[model samples]
Target: MLRELRWLMAGALATTLAACSPGDTELLAPRATARAPGRATTQQENLQAFARVYGYVRWFHPTDAASRTDWRALAAIGVAQVRDAATLDELRTRLVELFGPLAPRLDLWIDGESTPAPGPTPQGRDTMVYWQHEGYVGTRLSLYAPPYGQVRVNAEGPHRRRFTQAPAPDARVEVELVPGLHLRLPTVLSPADAEHDGEAPLDDAGLAHAARSASGYHDLDVRQGAVIEVWNVFRHFYPYQDTVEIDWPGLLAQALADAENDRTVDDTAATLWTLVHALQDGHGMVGHREIAARGRLPVRVEMVDGVPTVTGTDDPSHFAIGDVIEAVDGVALAPRVAHLADRLSGSPQWRRFRAASWESLTGPRDAAATVKLRRGRRALEVDAHFNASEPAQPPRPPQLHRFDDGTYYVDLTRAQYEDLEPALPEIAAAPAVVFDMRGYPSNTHKILAHLLREEENADWMHVPQVLAPDGHIVGWDPIGWHVRPAEPHVQGKLTFLIDAEAISYAESILGYVEAHDLGTLVGTPSAGANGDIVRVDTLGGFFVIFTGMKVTRHDGSRFHVEGVQPKVAAAPTLAGLAAGRDEVLEAGLANARTP
Candidate 1:
C-alpha cells in the first residue's frame, strides 16, 4: 500500500502537471485525504521509508558511480530533496525521520541539528510548519555556493532543462560519499552570505590563479573524480600499467580541511571544483550531480539560434516573454557557452561532440530561466517561459543497411533495443554487426534487460557507490529493480560506435561489449562523466539525476566515471558534421574488416 501510494503520488503529480508550467501558482487540486499518516502510514512504521535515497546508496550500494560524499553532498541531497518536494508535511515527516530520528548516518548529528526554526505562519502569526515534505523541496534552491567558484560534479550524462526551474549558483559545490552512515551536515553560507561572513568570492583572475596552482597537481578533468578511482582500481586492479601517481595523503588531508574550512562550505566547494576541473579530461567533472540539488531563479525559456529567448515565468507580474535572455545571475550565458565550446574544440574529435553538446543546449531545447535580457537593445529582467519541444529532427533514426558481403548495419539508438534484439539471431548468422551506442539508454529497463541478459534474470539488482578522494568506495541500493533479460545476442565481431556522450549505463555497455566480446569496441575516449547518472526531473538549477543504482554488467563492476576507451579512436567536428561525415563509424567499419 505504501509503495502504491508513493507511485500514485509521483504518477499523479506527473500526469496532472506535465503540461502545466512549473512557475504556475495554481494550487494542485486536493483530493479526499487518505487516512491520516499516523493512522495509516504510521502502522507501516519504519523511518527508512521517508529518508532520501542517498544513505541507501552510500553504504550498501555497489557500483562506483556516486563516488563519495562529504558534508556538501550529504546536506545538499537532504535539503535538495525536501526543497523539491510538493508538500510541507511530507518534508517535515521525512526530515524528522531522517535527520530527526531514523538518520542512517548518525555521526554527522543530523537528527538533533535539523530541528524546526520559526517562520511566518499561514496567517502570518510566525509559527513554522515542522513537516513540509512536498512544498519544502519545490524549486526554491534552499542551498548553493558562493559566486565566482566552480564545482566538480560527476554524472553519466548531461541533463535536459526543459521542464524545471532556474539554476542555483555558478560557484563550486563539491561533494563525495564517505564510509558509514554519517549524519547530516548544516547548510553553510552561499556567496552573498559568505562574503558577508568575511569570505571573498573568487573572480576570473582568481580562477586562473587556482587553475595554475592545481596544474602543479592534476590537470582539471571533469571526470577526474567520483567513481573514476574505483574504476581505475577495480576495472584493472590498478590500471595505467604502471603505478599511477595520486595524492592519496593529500586527498585525505583535503577532505578534512574542506569539511571544516572557515571560508564557508560554498567557497570551499568552489575551490574544490576548480581543482577537479584542472584535471583537463572531458570525462572529469566537478559540480552538482542533480539540478534540483540547488536553488534557481524564476523564469521559463528556450534557446533560439544560440540566443536565450524568454517565454514565461510564474509571476509575469515582474518579467515576461519575448525578451532576449543574455545572462543568468551576473554571468553571460554566451560567454560560458563559448568557453565550453572552446574547451571542447581541442578534443581529437571536437566537431561531433562540440556540435552535439552545443546543439543539446541550443535552440528549441526547452528552457526555463531567470535572466537578464536584451531585446531591441534594451536590457531587462525576465523569467523565461518553457514548453516541451517536438522531438529533435536532425539525428533521424537510422534504417538498417544490409550489405551483400554478409555484413549488416542496423541503425540503433540506445533506447531502440527491442527493435533490433528480436533480429539478433538473424544477425548472428551474419559475419559482422554494428551497434551504435552513442547515447544513453532511453527506454525503461525492460528493453535493455532483454538485450543484456545471457540467462533471464528474474530480479533486477544493481548497486551504486561513490569513491572518496582517499579511494574508499561508499554505496547505495535503488529500490525499484526490474528483471534482467536472459538472452544476449551474437558473440560475433561487433563494433560499437561510441563518442563522448556514451556514459554511465552506456559506458557500462562498453564493458559488456568488451568483456563479452560481442564486438570490437570503437570510438573516442568517452566523456567519462559516469556514475549514478542524473536526469531531467531536477526542479531548480540542481542537476537532479538518477541518484540511484543502475543495472550493472556481469562482473559486478559498474564503474561509470572514467569512461570506456575506444579500441580505435576518431574525433568529430562541426565542420565534419556539415560535410555528412561520421569519422568514428568509418573507422569502426575499417576496424571490423580485418581479413
Candidate 2:
C-alpha cells in the first residue's frame, strides 16, 4: 500500500510538471559523482538522489512553492528511500517512482554513470552571491561562505568603484550603496578551494551531455550567438560614445545571464532594452513585431500644471477626461514617472516627453494596472485593464492653413516639404510664413533648401563615416542640398513653430534655420535625440535600433542632448488647454509679426 501511495503521488507530480512550458524549468549543469566504477554504497546513492531532487524542485516548481509544500521535507523523505534500497537498480527505481516522468529532465547521473563535462566557472576561493534589489546592486558572501575570508567587489555604471573587505569571523561586511544605471559583482569565490579549478575541460561525451541538458529548453546556442554578434557590431560602428554613458562589460554579463535564464523572447527583449537605454541615445531601441503592437492602456495622461492628468480616454466607463492620476500600481505617480524615465533614452526633456504619457506605462493585454486618481478632490483607486483592440487613429494636424492676413501656415507633420512646391508661388506672395514644425518632418533638407540663399552655403549637414573599429571618428562627409531658383523663394519673414514634439529631422531643419538666420523659432525645446538610425538583428530574433550617424550644425555645435533652442520659448497653459486655445501656435504667429 505504501509503494502504491508513492506511485500515485509521483504520477500526480508528473501531470503538474507537464502543464509548464519547456522553458519554465530551471537548468542545471550535469553532475556525476567521481568514484570508482563499482557498486555504490547506500549513503552515496542517497546523496546523489538528494542532489537531483533538490535541483528538480528549484527549477520546476513555482518560485513561491515554499508556502505550498515543504520541499526540503520531501527531499529528505526521498533521500531516506534511496538509502534504504538494497541495490543500484532498487535506488534507480525509487528515484523514478518519486520523480515520475519528470525524472529524465533533471539530467542527474548516479555513481558509475558517465558524468557530464564541467562548464566554466568564475575563479575565486570565497562564496559570492550577487543580486539586484530595489534599484540597488551589491554582492556579499553566500551563507555557505567560510568564517573568515577576503572579498573584493567591483561595481561599474556611470562611474567605477571597487571595494575590498576583510570581514570579522562572524559578521559580513555591509557594502556602501552608490547609485548607478547598472551594477556588477566580480570575483565570486568557490567555497571548496581558492585555487581549485571550478570546471574541468569537456570531451566529446561532455559536449553531448551539454546538448542533452539543453534539449527541452529554448535554444541557448542561438541566443549566445546573437549576443556575440551585437557586441561585435556595436564595437565596430557606434559613433557617439561621449553621449552614451554605460558599462558595456557589466551590461553584457547581465545580458548573458538573462539569455541563460530568460523563458521567452519578451523576457530577452526587456533585458536588451535595459542595456540599450543605458546609452541614452533616443534612437536606441530593442524589440520585435510582437512588442511593437503590444496593447496599451485606453487612456492618455498628459502633464498639465506639473500634474499627470487624464487628457483623453478610449474607455470612458473606467476613466474620465480631466481625472488626475496620483499613483500607479501602488507607487506614487512621481516615483513611477522617475522609474519609467530610467527605461527611456534621451535628455531630461526628451525623457520627460517619452515618459509623460500613460501609454508609456502600459504593458501587454493581460497586464492589469492599478491606478489612483483624483477628480474634483475625490480620490479613488481603480483597477485598469489593458485594451487588446487596435489603437484609434490619431487626429491629423491640418496640412496647410491660410489666414485672412495673407499669412500661410504649413504643418510639417502632415505636409512634406515637396508638397510645398506648388504652394511656393502663394508662399512667396505672402507677407509672412509660419512653418508648423511642432512635430517631425519627412525630409529636413527639402524644406531647409528653400531658406539658403548662397550655393556654397547650401551644404549644411555632415555625417560621420566609419573607417575603423576603434570608435574614433575617421572622417566627415559634408552633404549639399541646393534649392531650385523657382519663383525667387520666399523672401518674406519666416517663423518656425516648434515644441517638445519637434525631434530628429525636425531638429535637423531647425539647426539649419538657426545657423543661417533663415527663420525665427518659437515654442518649447525639441526632443534631443537626432541623426539617422542603425538597426541590428540578433540570432534570437530580436532587433535593436540605435543612432548610427553623428549630426552637427555647420558651426560644429552638437544637436544631441542640446536640441534646437527656440527664440521665443512658450508652452500651453492649463487654462489655455481648457479653453481649447493653441498657445504655442499663437506665440509662433506673434513671432511671425515681430519686427
Candidate 3:
C-alpha cells in the first residue's frame, strides 16, 4: 500500500516536471533504498509533493492574496508544514491548510475520489486570465530593469481585474490531475502576479537581513525551501528543458533529499550547485561569497597529453611552463579535477577546461599548497602560495601585432572595438588576419561590419513567449544583431582562434562568422551554452544564474550543447608550451595564410 502511494505521488510530480509531454514513469520510479525506515526518505517525498503544488500556486494562481503574499516566507512555512506528511490524504489537507488563503480556488483529491467542479466564470468576461511573458528574466531588485524591454501581459488588459477582485480570482480553479499534480489546464487562463509590482527595493543590508531572518540560517525548513524555490523556477522557465536530457522529476527528488541532509551553508550551496549543474548551461552558477573569495594558484593549467600541465603562470619560481602536475595537497590530480568538474555546468570540453584551469587550484586565501610535478622524467615536490585574488596574467601580447610575413594578429579577447576601429584600414590591407577568440571578446563584433559586403540579418536568439507553466512556449521572439557593409572591405583571408573558453557573447560573434562564412574557425569547439543570463535569488541567500533564452545557430538549428564547432581542430601541446609557442595561434595563422 505504501509502495502504491509512492508510485502515485511520483506520477503526479512527473506530470508537472515538463508539461510538454507525458511523464516518464521509469525515470520517476521510486528509488531502491536499502536503509532502514526513516524520515529522510519520507521528507524527500513530502517536499517533492509540496514543490509540485508550490509552482502552481506561486506562478499560476491569479488572486490578490497570492499576488500580495511574501512567497519566500510561504515557501519556508510550506516546507515545514508538509515535510512530515505520512499519506496522500495528509498531504492534501496540509497543502490546503497552507495554500487555501492564497488560492481560494485550489482543489486537490485522491485519484479514485470524485473531483470538485470549477467555479462559474464571471459575468461579462469572455476571455480567461493567463500569463504572457515576453522575456521573464528574474526578480533581483524592484528597481532593476533589463536593457531590453520585458513585458508581462498578466497585469495589462482584462487580467488587471483578476488581482483586484475576489470573484475574478474565484472564477477559475487549479485542479490536481494525477492525485498529487496541481496545475491549471491549458484551456484555463490563470494570470501570474505583476512582475515585481509594488515590491519595495531591497538594499544590501535589507537583502542580508531578509535572508537571515527567514526561519533562521540553520533551519532545515529554510534549506529545503531554498531547493524548492530554485527547482521550481527552472522547472517552469528553463528554455532548454526539451533540449537537455535530464531526468527532471528525479533531479527534484534528489535535490530535496540532499537538502534534508544539509548542515552548513556550504552544504546547501553544494546541493544548489548540483541542481544547476544538471542543466549543462555554461552560464549556470551558484553565487556564495565564501566560495567566490577562495584563493587561487597563480598558474593556468590545461589538459596536455591527458595530464594536467602548467601552461601559463605569474609565479615562475614555484612552477614552470610545461611542468606536469601529478597531485595537489595530497590529492591525486585526476580526482581533484573530477570533483571540480562534477560541480561545474557546461559542455564536456568547457567543464574540463574550467576545472583544470583555475577551479581545481583554489584553496584558502594565502594558504600554502604542496604540488607534485613531473618535469623531464624528474619528479619533484614544490611548495606554492595561493593569491588572495585571481593572480594577474603576464602582460598580453600587443592587441594588434603585425607578423614578419605581413599577417595581422588581432586579439579580440583584449582589443576594444574603439581601439581597433582606426586600425581597420591597416588590417584590411594585410595579406591575412588572425582573430584570437580563445576567450570572451570585448565588444569586437562590430568588426563584422567591415568584413561584410552587404547588410545581413542573423536572428540567432529565440526568447520564449512563456504562457503556461512548465515552459510551454506559445511563441518565440527572434532576436540578433544586424551588420551592414562598411569601408575598406578586407581582401585578406580571415581566421578565428577558438576554444572551450569562448562562450555566450563570444559564441554570438562566432555564430555570425559561421553563418556568413566570414572566417575559418581554428582550435577546439566553443562552450556549448549561450544566451543572456538571468540571476534568481533564493530564500536562503544563495542565488543561481542560467541562460534565460534559447540561442541557436544562424540557420536556427539547436546550439545549446553543440556550441560552435571549429572548421580546423587544434589545441596546445606540452612541447609547444615548453618552447613558448602558441600552437593554437600558429594554427590560426596557418589557416589564414591558406588561399
lDDT-superior candidate, 2 or 3: 3
TM per prediction: 0.38, 0.57, 0.84
Distance from true location, Cα of 531 in model 3, Å: 0.5
TM-score pick, better of 1 and 3: 3
Candidate whose TM-score is highest: 3
Residue 520 displacement (Å), model 1? 0.9
Candidate 2 wrongly placed segments (more than 4 Å) = 1-227, 242-246, 254-267, 298-300, 310-323, 327-334, 358-361, 365-397, 417-419, 443-445, 456-467, 482-485
Clash number by candidate, in order: 106, 1, 0
Across 1-595, the per-residue lDDT of candidate 2 in tens digits comes to 4323332221000111111123322333332334322344454334433333433332221122211332323333443455565554455456555543222222223333342222233343133221111110112224432111111222122111112221111111111011100001111222221222212112234222322332212455444434444544454345566556667556655655566667776666666766676677776767666666667667766566787766557777777766777887777776666666677777776776667663355667767998888876688888877664532222323677778887888887778667877787787777888888876677636755566776435444544443112243334555544454334477778998877667777777777688778888888788777765656654444677776666666676666777888888887655665454667888888888777
- Please state the error at residue 153 of candidate 2 in Å: 45
The models' CA-based lDDT, in order, is 0.36, 0.52, 0.70
Among these predictions, the greatest lDDT belongs to 3
Model 3, 510-554: lDDT tens per residue? 888888898899999999888878888777667889888899888
As a whole number from 0 to 100, the lDDT of residue 144 in candidate 3 is 45
